[model samples]
Target: MSFKSRTLLFVICLFVVSNKLVATPKVKTIPIFNIQVDSLIEQQSIRNDMTQLELLVLYNDALKEKKPADSVNIFKKLAILNADLGQPEDALIYTEKYIKNTLDFSILNSEAYNVIRGSEAHKELSENYMLQIDWISFIFLYVALIGFFFTVIINFSKKANRCAKLFISGFVGVHSLFILEFVLYISNIQYRLPHTYLIAALTALLYGPFLYLYFKSVTYNFKFRTIDLLHFLPTLILIVYLFPMYSLSSNDKIEIMLEINNSYNINRYVIFISKVVSLFIYAILIGKFHYSRRKEEDSIKGKKPVNRWKKTIYAIHVIYLVSYIIYGLPVSGLMLSFPYFINYIQVSIMSVMVIYLAYMAYVQPEIFKSYSVGTSENTIPPLEKYQKSGLTNALSEELKGNLIRLFVEDKVFKENNINLEELSKRLNTTRHNTSQIINEHFNINFFELINKFRIQEAIRILKEDIHGSLNIIDIAYEVGYNNKVTFNKAFKKETSLTPSEFINMQIKKGLYK
Candidate 1:
């Protein structure tokens, strides 16, 4: 055989073997195993559906049974399940129910809640439940309560000028009411108790007028006239304007509160602007009047306390005006950029002012006394009253020198029970002559002269008491004041500083020695 013929025969044999292998058939597998596997999966799905149905029934029963604890637990479970099942909207509903039932802000941070946390509903829900106690509002409330008590006491107290007391009472009372409304507004208590709506707005216009009138009454001893009623015309107009809101039902008011952003209409901005403008204008008026009086009081020696008090009051008013302007400009769209906290600062200024006035009322009741420096047409002048006196100028000068010697060298003003009569005896003069000498020579009343000497001595003693052993009452007693109130009054009159304030100032200045 040739070599090519042998190779061809071997290839044919391999091809025949491949054909035989291709023609051969293997054993067949059964379809029953796949069918059984599918059945098991179906059964598991049925069990899951049945379990979910049972949970739903149980949840409904729990609701019907009024079981809050059980309902909350079920709500959480259902929410998580719904989230895992790709039904996020349902999950959020159940989450809201859980949060509403428990008010549990902590739950929103759960890993399982991540599915719905990105939704806007979750954000709103979190905001609704997350409320921190507003400490500033609480402070305002406390001051308002003090203001109320002060108003009641000053109205009835026999001390001080009745007209001044009335004006101050109105100022404090109106401010207190405003603070209360502010508390409601900021703390969201107004939405719950809807009657508080527009109450602050109604009184907004009263702040400037009341404060202006108070300064007038206290400083100039100006009596209230019927024309003064016109100062409150803006307040009356505000009441009329807000009457619609005030007359709304509680539910309607709550609805308005919910949609508060939409309710800031032109009228609202107008009202807000009016409040700030009116307050600023009145503050300016007060400044002008106060400046003129301050200049006059500066010429006099014994008006230090009242002058200082007025300056402090005016400074506080400026602070409030600045803060309120900052707050109001944004609300009224006058200034574009302003911090949100300025409103709080404005209210806090008022609160601090109330607290300060209350303190002064307690410490220096004499400050509220009718200080009529101007001689009214119906009143007798101090000089005129002394016109018929027989006291000679020579005798007056001698008595004045002796009185000065008694106060300066002997420190006789330390006698707690010392009065004009006792002082006259010390100077070997009559009480009338001593009064004339104090008035003419010192340009102050006998009480004022005594207080000036006593306060000067008190300052000397306080400066020497570097050991800090002397308390206010002790220093007061050492200065010939029968009580701490009188002592505080005397001390503040001369130095325009409270006892503690003077000590602190000295400490700050390193002049404690």
Candidate 2:
């Protein structure tokens, strides 16, 4: 199809899909809704003469009227509405409040309205969702720093001071993301509290380039220049944005706040511009890094595995950048089809990729080893076995423990059941170190850690069940196998039993339950 034709079709799809939202009648909040919904909404407020369902409409009506602080009221109403609504797939999906379960993406997806307690409560939806910045977001805010400080300790202990400082800057950059989220949530025109224009613009200034540096550092071995001070250039510009709000009457402050908010939209234009700039910066680095290695390979003539892993690491970085663009760019509301896109800006998804990159960077440091421009593998020694482990943490104890956890214990990358990442999230430790420490202590690698769980799950299913109505395929998937054929081969190799034999033997032995 032609590009114009494809673009036309996409536009049509957006209209078609959005009709349900735009055209649907605003159902009466109480008459059509039930006592259960009323009870649900009632929890948010003690003054419940009007049913909670009534409040949903009140908030929406208020928002339509541009009622100040109506959104804050809506969020209060939603906190109660959410319980009766069950899972908040559609509601929270568009809402700025990122209350989502990371491990189980499906739990909050595709939820249709189910009725109970009589009146058909018809999804008590929000056209403008509650984007309240509360203590909750601050909790995730520290993630960047937590990852950062640990990187510092890792580098400092290794005595790589330059890399440690670079990492600390990157960590500060990452920290600003939460800061941005917090500022937006608080300053959302919907709530209209005393608008902290100072906080809003200054935090935004701090966030953008920090993110740019973080990505560049991981992608290229680019050293921070003395001119790297330019990243803080925007925060310095915020003095102008804050000047208009001072010494205003409450009414005057509202006018000033509106001007600030309007100006903020212009500020959004700045973000889109920065986003494009950041994208170009990343691409240039990716290109420079890619061909430089190819040239080096031509000069030296080494077997490719040494360089091959490095290439894979670069490829993953591209995938991550693409995924970020997929979710992050659209969430900016710049594109025409923005709302139609599936948002994957969840911290968990990003965390998965970040964890993977860190793992690959550590496991295969040739990618990160920072050769001179145009230099190649022809000159450098193949990454040593110890070198692979050492890149993550060079000490023998660190290497042994990491390999054990990565290969033998299988925690971080496990697809199903218990895992290192899951355990870390449960325990709240950084993922890189979990692998590093586990690898150091146990002397296993990541794959072994995960596959062991898969193999064990398969065995338990066979031994514990007598009435095995589900087949080998079922057991394999139940244990998180992507396919049964692989599971059967692994099961046979590991436990001396093909799945069918294992199930049959279990039946004869009466072990199935």
Candidate 3:
């Protein structure tokens, strides 16, 4: 066949196949009885005075219909109604059906579930079903925590600061224990790890101290001292007191677990309360420190106000304090008395907090500038002679004027990737000379100097375009910022007001249309 004939044949074959695939009819099965059941359920559910017996009748009819998905919803309604009517055993049976059909174990720790857990009828179902299905949540938390821990580790490795490293390490240790406990619980092998409870108890004692250290380290640039070891005394004492549990026989360990589980041990309650009290104290201390730091920064002139890192750390502490009050205190026995679903809700909140923490840590700004850390004053002579380079004072003055002209008239600072090397090249000078001049004259790093000009330009534009001609994001890009977040941060740092707030202030002053 010729080329055109062969191509035509292939096209015809593809078109026929495509049409057949598109025109094919789909097969679906529908349960005729489920339609009637759904209609009845919807009608009864909407009625103001539906009786428990009527709900039970619907549930029985749903079971006889043998439609698993529809029956599951009916079983859930029946469970709630039976429990309300004080028929816990019947409620539990229906709850089990709902859980099995839906693969949801959120009700495993409910009062009704607890009532039937020890009963002979639901023993296997309660123990096996609860653990098996809950493993899904456990695995998710485990993986997420591991990822968070390593993320912090990567941050610590880059900076190599003792205080921050220890702070993050302590948190990783605590989270590791949580993962281990979940593992043992879900695997039904907690007794094999007999020392788990004692270790967890001891670890809990470090939670408040480590958190305190983390805030202290970031806010105050703390250095670890011998006195700092005293903070671990409480954790040590806990380990010593629980030392006996470490060597207990398997049977004895099981008894201790039972006692702890039943809240029969007064010491366990005491430890929990102590941890909460300690965290509260640290939170107050950190709040005071933050206030002092803010006051100190406010006193400095020509410096950008608002330390975002400090605020982020302080917010984390606030979250910790609130979480302890909600989920830690004994008087806040809400978690215990509430449904099992409440536990998962708490877990979800903590997971979000962890993710936020990881994000903040990952993007934490440089605490120390490059020249501030390793370079010494003696290494470079005084700025008067331009030191080892032999550049005269007159020439340095000329270069400074030229640099100002480039920034002010040329508007070179608007470029997103402007840096010392680029600036040095523009000035036809060595990078070292350019950096020294910026440090000595401006008393700031290259990035800070660039951002200062950009922020000033942004303010000018905001004032000129008054009738909201350009939105905050558009203004950010127009002023040389590549993204809105960095622009907002820089603007707020310089002016102590967000872009929107600045625009509003301009409008109030009649500077903007």
Cα lDDT tens digits, model 2, 199-268, are 4334434433544454344333567788987767655655455445433444444443334333323344
What global local distance difference test value does model 1 have? 0.72
- Give the local distance difference test score of model 2: 0.47
TM-score of 3: 0.51
Per-candidate Cα RMSD to the true structure, in Å, reads 15.8, 25.2, 23.8
Candidate 1 minimal-lDDT segment of 10 residues = 24-33
TM-score of 1: 0.56
The Cα error of candidate 3 at residue 273, in Å, is: 1.2
- The residue pairs that clash in candidate 1, if any, are none
Say which prediction, candidate 1 or candidate 2, comes out ahead on lDDT: 1
Off by over 4 Å in 3: 1-120, 123-125, 128-135, 144-158, 219-221, 245-247, 259-266, 294-310, 329-336, 353-401, 404-492, 495-513
TM-score of each: 0.56, 0.37, 0.51
Highest-scoring model, lDDT: 1
- Order the numbered candidates by TM-score, best leading: 1, 3, 2
- Which number leads on TM-score? 1
On TM-score, who's better, 2 or 3? 3
